[model samples]
Target: MPKPEHPTDPDVEISASATARELRFHARPEVTVHAEAEPGGECAWGSDRTNLPDQVEPNVTYRDIRIDFRVAAALTDPTQDPSSP
Candidate 1:
């Protein structure tokens, strides 16, 4: 049987508490990634401390966090073709 076709645009949801110190993202099967923090929460992207919120109250749970993923590059032998088996 043939493999099913995956959606070109996919939705990914992440949940976390306000007290969470940091959030990290790792690219899977690709070298590039894009993500955004949903509204109704106090948080920011990247490692620069200046960009983060001043305070994150404890016991606060955040929902509807969404992230998007796409293929930037394949991790494989440079001499080999990426599409080759």
Candidate 2:
């Protein structure tokens, strides 16, 4: 087989992972993987406060989300997406 490329940052050590309880293999075992882009951002927002009789403001932050869909014992397609006819 071929070596798996680095998907996540090498600096972030992966010392723990959940067990795969959903897997059934036979003669020819296989897998399918899917991924999509996620939005991320950070900004500031205004709020209401009664203490100082002024516009209360606070900083906001957003994180990147990545979902991975995997199917066990599946086949891979040469083209990730089928060409339109």
Q: How does each model score on TM-score?
A: 0.18, 0.17
The backbone clash count of each candidate, in order, is: 0, 0
Q: How does residue 18 of candidate 2 score in lDDT?
A: 27
Q: Write the per-residue lDDT of candidate 2 for residues 1-85, one digit (tens) a residue.
A: 1112432222222221223323322333243334322222111112222222222223322123222222112132445554544
1-85 per-residue lDDT for model 1 (tens digits)? 1111332232432333233344433322233335432332122222212223324344444343333222211122447664678
Which 10 consecutive residues of model 1 have the lowest summed lDDT? 1-10
Looking at model 2, residue 20 earns an lDDT score of 34
State the RMSD for candidate 1: 15.9
- lDDT of model 2 at position 48: 25
The lDDT for every candidate, in the order shown, is: 0.31, 0.26
Off by over 4 Å in 2: 1-25, 39-85
How displaced is residue 14 in candidate 2, in Å?
7.8
